[model samples]
Target: MSGFERSETDEFARGARALVIYPELPGRASVGPEARLAESEGLALAIGLNVIRKKHYRVRSPRAVTLLGGGQVEEIAEMGRDLEADLLIVDASLTAIQQRNLEERTGLKTIDRTGLILEIFGERAATAEGRLQVELAHLDYQAGRLVRSWTHLERQRGGFGFLGGPGETQIEADRRMIRDRMARLRRELEEVKRTRSLHRARRKRAPWPVIALVGYTNAGKSTLFNRLTRATVLAEDMLFATLDPTMRQITLPGVEKAILSDTVGFVSDLPMQLIAAFRATLEEVISADIIVHVRDISHPESDAQREDVLHILRDLGVLDDEQAGNQPRMVEIWNKLDLLDDDRRTELSGMAARDDNILMISAETGEGIDAFKAHLTALIAKGNDLRTVKLRTDNGAALAWLHGRGVVSRQYVDGDIVSVDVSLSRQLWGQFEKQFENQIERANA
Candidate 1:
């Protein structure tokens, strides 16, 4: 099997003997030590893949042809052949040449971390936008192995041995085709962007607030989104169980309706290519007036995961650099409080009260939900108050102008005049001022 055939083989099976390779310092001395093998197996099981047989390898020689000695590769291949294993899943980046070479030697299909992720995305993508993003990422990864099928083309040719030409060749044409498809994908995503803007505009008109659900994968974002909003989105303990973004109208404790959006979960070492692919979806976090940094307080790396999320947010320019002296309106949802012991929960609660922009609550058991709602209500009130204006309505045009640019909270009408109160952004206020230039000019005159 080559190219497309192996690509097809990468999917799940009922009784697949899967060998997950997590390389360590090779030849240092070890005996079949599985590096995170159980974790990898659990991840596979989440996607319905049955892993029957498993093994691990510790290889040194970072640039070796086999990543190990010839004897070692032969021994491993012999084991696979003896056990009739179905797949080899390497939990690291692998070059096309290395992949093809390994598969040929092992007589089994080979895949890397990137390919496995793309496979999962392909299966989980629920919307047109999600599918397009996955396809774009897949194409970027696949472009490197255009001629993996034809080894003849990889042989020493006119220019460079095993690489052929100095600059480009037929494989370059395949890369160009991928680029052309990507450009078209970018254009299609622009339409998705426009649709997202329209949705944001509609949400901006909502009487409540917008709270975005964000955290590491399987940190229970969807469960919290469902509990808070009475939604039925898929909530499971799996890596990337949710692919598309889902939004629901929630009634918080203060009788306030808020739009709670469940976003794609973050992971450790979220591939750069996948990040670029899913940038459009992540703008939800950026547009979010308030961010709910839900955490799996039980996870060993929970602190590091929180740091990663904040780092990415700041890098994207969404996180403010200012001290934000005012009570941060940003609620830290200490989700999965149900998972913590009473003492741990008490300690965290005290910490949250002392900290700004932090809220401690379990989205699953509905614990501390009232406090979460109250905190959200206060933030919403503050966010809405960021801009407000009172206007005398002698000029119908000015009234009409403000109406287009913002939401009208109150209106009063009397003889030959009208009084109106509106809430708007400063930028929108600028637009209203531009639209009513004639009135401003006459007043100045």
Candidate 2:
């Protein structure tokens, strides 16, 4: 095996170096080349690769063989050799043929954007379900590159006179193996999805509403989750820092208790394979009663990042312009206020004040947290009903159910009957009525 084969396991070793490149094609003016290059470098760093050199090339037209001009390829190859880079990271999608050709010409291991993201996900996945999802996605991505991986098996082999002329090729055998693994992974993932559905059903039977945190990658979602729940998650300034979804019970101002779920962050050009594989995980966002979109207001590309997040949400059916009234309510959390200047902070505060669904706060400084909590409490209360009911003293289960599912204000015992004042959401009230119909003598809402 040459360096290209060893590069897979040794490229991220202590002394190994990598060269990063971003191909800026014509008519791609939404995001600048510098920003793309920086993001690519960040992706490389997330995997512990030592990025030695970063470059951007303006390509008029992409070549099918190498995806870059001959001169550009040669120049990049020369730079990689000069820097002693063990691998090249390309911030663009490449076909298997293009990747093989590039590696052959440059004598370096090469990876594209999708492959890079998949590697990050593979490295950061901590839970069993997360690992399964990552493996499924990796298999899906690798299934398409079998043609380049097993070219040696393309030649026919001599066999017995009556036996087959070419048995199964290496490519076919590998593809079959990948397909079998993918099938098993899909079955496991389906079971995981079913388990999640049961969990969600249990939560529904309870009274607490679920609030999910969603935003662009590294946009302070984990910070806000930690601030609200006071539980430390990996809140770092890195892309895809939180891959597995985490749920914690939090108390709102007047709401008593609510479940807060911190989920994986979104990014521009997210791989479709990840989306398909992690659909079970992202279902949390779709099932949440309220979706809180946390934004890093200090970043220069905040608006663009917000659009990307919204686009992913729309694709997931969590946000729909046509049926906006039917979907779950959304709140915009302008986080990282501490990073801004005094004047900009004041301006944002004024803007948030004018919108009922927006809150400007700093999770790090605990600024405006009380107000955000109060707003969230009020939003949750909007769907609840204050009611008074009477139950028999012997029905302790009914009383405990009410206390667990709702906020009980006053209670009085008279003879064998108990009078209770409580607040419950419409759904909980319906459940209560169904479960305690005979025990209740009178009810008023």
Candidate 3:
């Protein structure tokens, strides 16, 4: 019952000392090892772990047993002992055998990047659906690592207290139990997905548009969300501070209202299990009419971070393979301007000036927020144009359709004719003409 086998309360306590290590592999040069180590440290701190020591090693060839060289493993064990650390946090995914070997050699509880992120999610998940999703993902992860990771699973148990036949290994019983629980979680999550689809459909029928805010973790997305919507979500400088999806109604210039969604941040090497488990929540991003990509302009790896976010968006089918503008309109927001110096800020402003779709703003200081709102309004109103149509008094269905799909500015009745002025998007306008061409007498666009 060691490590993850125990309840969370008895596992890693708050303020537990931790030794953070990053393995720098060959042919991986997107981000420097130092920056990646810093991010890993932030993740450790986010889970309330006291990072006593941090270091990185160049792994010319990763070892199958420990993922690190024998000498490197010895060095880490000695460092952990000297630092009196309670945990060893590896900034890479490890197999169950590799993890067990590392724990035996390092003499400290060991967890990898995926496990650490899962722990943070398990803690930060606020809503019931979030907890369920986390549990399902945790179960999925633990299902394959039950061999030597959990010592209690080595025992044999009888049928009554176990899951399988009369004489079954506890590991088998535990695996069976996990499978059953996972099946139930999938069913429950399916229901949640159905519920989300219903809500999305209802919003689709509404006249207002949907805008989603997406970015790297702790990239000032929640800050921008609060700044725009005036709702107090937990805006912290910690990784994964927000896990569940939050939505609010906001009014953009030239638009009465739009649904704004603040979703979980994206990261490099995001666990595939999490991506699959949280599909119900990420669907909000897929159905968004517009996507606002928020970036931490002050971070050194901002460009790399942008690529990571875009990669995830593409994975979610929000973007096409060609990326030839056949997807939702997207705008890149350069946030955290307050953290940049004058020279860097000026340089970025020059770059943004050349890009029509990029906006430089400080979400915390409200700098350029008015312009941001106006730009958002422009994107929303891009294809919509004003049209005046005269219809017969009996064409009630067409009038209702116009009201449901467009912004009806004016309507008047004269004799047997009704004149209506509406602003409709190009797609909606095309639908209107196709559906009600015979019902209208005259139309001017």
Candidate 4:
């Protein structure tokens, strides 16, 4: 038996022992095998799977039937038997035939990387939209694996004399069911997307800058969000602690208020199913004015993780070539600075000083947070136009709107008129002009 076991009578106990395998292929060495293996273990642990052992294999050629060589399959089977593992987790994509063959050979339930991620998502999805998306992705994934024979398919079904000749085969029937269900899920998700778009449109009309926080999983994004907004989101030291997007109103140093969105974290080779399913949620990031990319600087794979996030962002069209002119500006926040030694921290601080876009901070200890807020305020202000305007004292509504929507740098009341200096984005200025067309006496920058 494996070192970890659960009692038979424990109702809440999880008992499956898993063997994790990461296969390293030639010409694909961006991320090291150790980091990949560690990530695989984290995924397994996220869903309460007891990973008893893990291994990295260098594969010259992947087998079509089993994905691993015959000798490797035999060796892994023996290892599984020795450790009494009931589950085999391959940290690589596998075809339906390859998965089935491996499961049959090892006498253990086998799941590839995509399947494992889908399973974790299935378990972690909490919101109605999240659940619907997960179900759609799961159906799409399972539709490709309907190849097993069933005894019921051998039997004939009685139907209307003229309506049918023979009942559908088990695989065909299952595939049809999956397709129908997927269609329904897609319809539901479409409604979700439409509703989300409506909400975003409403926010756009209000015209507050939306700042989105995105990063690799467990990169202290949630922690930074909590520190910045004082909102009690679930910030845990685990992979994917926060799956759903959460937004809050945050006030920067010199900015009145902005919407801060904390989004789902990215990972290396994030499954396509997840990316497709979570498109609506990720759209929040797409429409942001500023993208704050939080990084766990203390992690050994931080650079690799950053590349993965950038790749995903590009794929999502947030960082696309076509949208380059209008794409949101990104700020790199090197978080977890408190974990580094004094010398390393000083080195990183010096590096950040040379780049205005990068800010080093420890979200847990509140270091550099003040500087980050100031930096954000300056970045936002840089896009606005400064103007001086005179308004009537009776136009209190317009004055309040100006204060609410823009930065009022100077204000003074003289008799029946008010003079103010304000900075406003082009969109906000356009709205202001439409609302107070006649109230303005004179305006100059």
lDDT winner: 3
TM-score of each predicted structure versus truth: 0.73, 0.86, 0.87, 0.89
Over 4 Å off in model 4, which ranges?
A: 1-15, 149-166, 321-328, 391-395, 410-419
lDDT of 4 at 155: 31
Q: Write the per-residue lDDT of candidate 2 for residues 1-445, one digit (tens) a residue.
A: 1101122333357435888999887776456777778888888888888889999998999999999999999998999888888988888888899888888888888889898888888888889889889888877887888755433222321210122236866666667666766888899999999999999999886657899999988888998899999999999999889999999999876456789999999877888899889889999999998889999998877777878888788888888866442343888889998899989888888987887888888888999799888877666766679899998989999988887667666789999999998888888888999988988989987
Instruction: Give the TM-score (vs. native) of candidate 1.
Output: 0.73
Task: Summing lDDT over every window of 10 consecutive residues in candidate 2, give the lowest-scoring window.
Answer: 1-10
Candidate 3 residue-wise lDDT at 286: 88
User: Local distance difference test, per candidate?
Assistant: 0.67, 0.82, 0.85, 0.82
Runs in model 1 deviating more than 4 A are 1-15, 24-39, 53-61, 64-79, 149-173, 205-208, 253-255, 320-329, 383-445
* Candidate 3 residue lDDT tens string, 1-445: 1112232223678899999999987876568888998999999899789998889899999999998999999999999999899999999989999999999999999989888888888888888899888888877888989874664333423322447677977677788877877887899999999999999889876657899999999999999999999999999999998899999998765466788999998888888789888888999998898999999999999988888888888888788778723344999899999999999999999999988889988999999999999898778777789889899888899888876566666889999999988788877788889988788899997
Candidate 4 displacement at residue 317 in angstroms: 0.8
Q: Which residue pairs in model 3 clash with each other? A: none
lDDT measured at residue 104 in model 3 versus the true structure, 0 to 100: 94
In TM-score terms, candidate 3 sits at 0.87
User: Which runs of model 2 end up more than 4 angstroms from their true locations?
Assistant: 1-11, 149-166, 321-328, 387-403, 407-423, 433-444
Order by TM-score, highest first: 4, 3, 2, 1
- For candidate 1, what is the lDDT? 0.67
